[model samples]
Target: MENKEIILNILHEIKNGNIPVHTDYNLNLDMWADLIEYMHDRTYIADVTIYWFGDDDTYNDERVHSVNLTKVRLTTFGERFLTEEMN
Candidate 1:
C-alpha cells in the first residue's frame, strides 16, 4: 500500500484505541520504521517504542537487521490529519 494509505490506517487504528497497529506482512520493516519515525518526529503520533538490532556495537553491523514497532498511538494532530485526509 501507499505510504499515505498506511499512515491513515495507522492513525485510524490508534484513534479507535488500537495500541499497536500491525502492518501487512509484505511491508518492508525499514519502510515501516521510517514511516513511524517520520510521524513521531512530526508529532503526529506519540507513545511509541521502536526496537531494532544490527545497528549497534553489540551487533557489529552497519545495517539494521530488524525494526519492530512495539507501541504507538495517535496524537491530536494525527487525528486532525486523519480527519482531513478522509474528507
Candidate 2:
C-alpha cells in the first residue's frame, strides 16, 4: 500500500483503541520505521516509541532487523485528518 493509505490505516486503528497496530504488508522494517516517524514528525500521532532490533553497525546490511511501535495514539490533528479524508 502507498504511504498515505498505510498512514490512514494506522491512524484509524489507533483511533479505534487498537494499540500497536499490525500490518500484513510485506514492507521492510525501515519502511515501517519511516512511516511511524513520518506520522510522529507531522504531529499526527504522539507518545510513540519505536524499538529497533539490530546492531547499529549492521543496520545497512542484509542482516535481520525489526521495528516495533508502541505507545502510539492519534492526536487531535490525526483525528481531524481522518475526518477530512473521509469527507
Candidate 3:
C-alpha cells in the first residue's frame, strides 16, 4: 500500500483498538522511518495532535534499536477525520 494509505490504516487500527492505546506504541522502523514523519507532518497540518514521540531517554534506550517508541491516540479532530473524511 502507499505510505498515506498505510498511515491511515495504522491510525484507523488504533482508533478501533486493534492497536494498543495510551501506552507506548512500538513501530517497525523499516516501515516507519520513511513514512511516519510524513504522516505526522500531515496530522500537524490538519491541526490535530494524534501522536507524541517519546522523550530522549526512551529514544536512547539500548533495548530498541531501530524502532521508534511513540504514544498514539485519536484526538477529537482525528476521530472526526476517521469517521468523515477517511470513509
Candidate 4:
C-alpha cells in the first residue's frame, strides 16, 4: 500500500485500539517519521514523539528520528482526518 494509505490504516487501527508492532528495527521508519511530522504539524496527533535519541551507538544515523507507534494514538483531529479526509 502507499504511504498515505499505510498511515491512514495505522491511524484507523489505533482508533480501534489495535497496536501495531514491528520486529524489525527499520520497519517503515522513514514513513513513520513523515507521518509523525505531518500529524504533529497539523495537530492531528498529540503526545506522540518524533525524536532522535542522541545516542550515536544506538541510532547510528544522526538524521534518523525514532517514533514508537505503539505509544501513539489518534487525536480528535486525527480521527476527523481519517473519517473525513481519508475515507
Candidate 5:
C-alpha cells in the first residue's frame, strides 16, 4: 500500500478505541518496511519496551512485530472512522 494508505489505516485503527484485530493482523503485510523500521528507530519507545513480539528475536523477514496490547485507546481518528463506517 502507499504511504497515504498506511497513515490512513493507522489513523483508522487508532479511532476504533480498541486494538481489536485478528491474531494475524499484519504489521508488515505490504512493502511497508520503511514504516516499521522508522518505528523501531524510536528512542523513548525502545527505552520502556522490552519486545513487542513475545520473543527477543530480531525483526526478521516478517514485516511486523507481534503486539500484546495491554490497553488500547480510541483516538479522534478512530472515532471518525467508526462514525463514518457506521453511517
Candidate 6:
C-alpha cells in the first residue's frame, strides 16, 4: 500500500487512543516505521499522548501521540489529511 493510505489508517487508531498490541499489526512489515516517521514530520499531530497510569506500574511510559482524526477538529493538518485537500 502507498504511504498516504497507510497513514490515514494509522491516524484512525491514534485519535481513539486504542492502539492494539503489536500482534495486531505486522512487526516485520515493511514501511510501518517509515509511515510513523513520515507522519511524525509531515503531520501536525497533537502531542497528546496517552499513558497507562495505573497503580501497578512505575517503570515504562506507554505514551503515544495523536495522528488520526476523522472529525478534523484541531488544526489544519488534520483537516487537510481528512479532506485530502490540495493547496
lDDT, each prediction? 0.71, 0.74, 0.49, 0.66, 0.40, 0.46
> After best superposition, candidate 6 residue 3: deviation in angstroms?
2.2
Of the candidates shown, which would achieve the greatest TM-score relative to the real structure? Answer: 2
**Over 4 Å off, model 5:** 20-65, 72-87
Order the candidates by TM-score, highest first — what do you get?
2, 1, 4, 3, 6, 5
Q: How many times do residue backbones clash in model 2?
A: 0
Winner on lDDT between 3 and 4 is 4
Report backbone clashes per prediction. 0, 0, 0, 0, 4, 1
Better of 2 and 3 by TM-score: 2
User: For residues 1-87, could you state the per-residue lDDT of candidate 5 as single tens digits?
Assistant: 554455445445544543423223354423333443333343101211223333446745443444433343444444555457546
Off by over 4 Å in 2: 20-23, 52-68
lDDT of 4 by residue, 2-84 (tens): 65776677677778887654322245666557666786687766667666656457756655456766567678888888998
Which one wins on lDDT? Answer: 2
lDDT of 6 by residue, 5-79 (tens): 555655656555555232345533223434454555676454432223332467464333332333322246764
| Cα misplacement distance, residue 49 of candidate 1 (Å) | 1.5
Once fitted onto the true fold, the runs of candidate 4 whose alpha carbons sit more than 4 angstroms away are: 21-27, 53-61
Worst 10 residues of 2 by lDDT: 60-69
What tens-digit string does per-residue lDDT give for candidate 3 at 1-87?
Answer: 554556667667767656422222344543454354455565621322233355356564323233332445566665766677586
| Angstrom error at residue 25, model 3 | 15
With a 3 Å backbone cut-off (N, CA, C), the pairs that clash in candidate 4 are none
Candidate 6 accuracy as lDDT: 0.46
Model 1 TM: 0.72
Residue 19, candidate 3: how far off, in angstroms? 2.7
Question: Lowest-scoring 10 consecutive residues by lDDT in candidate 3?
Answer: 44-53
- Residue 77 lDDT, candidate 2, scale 0-100: 95
Cα deviation of 26, candidate 2, in Å = 2.2
> In angstroms, how far off is 55's CA in candidate 4?
9.0
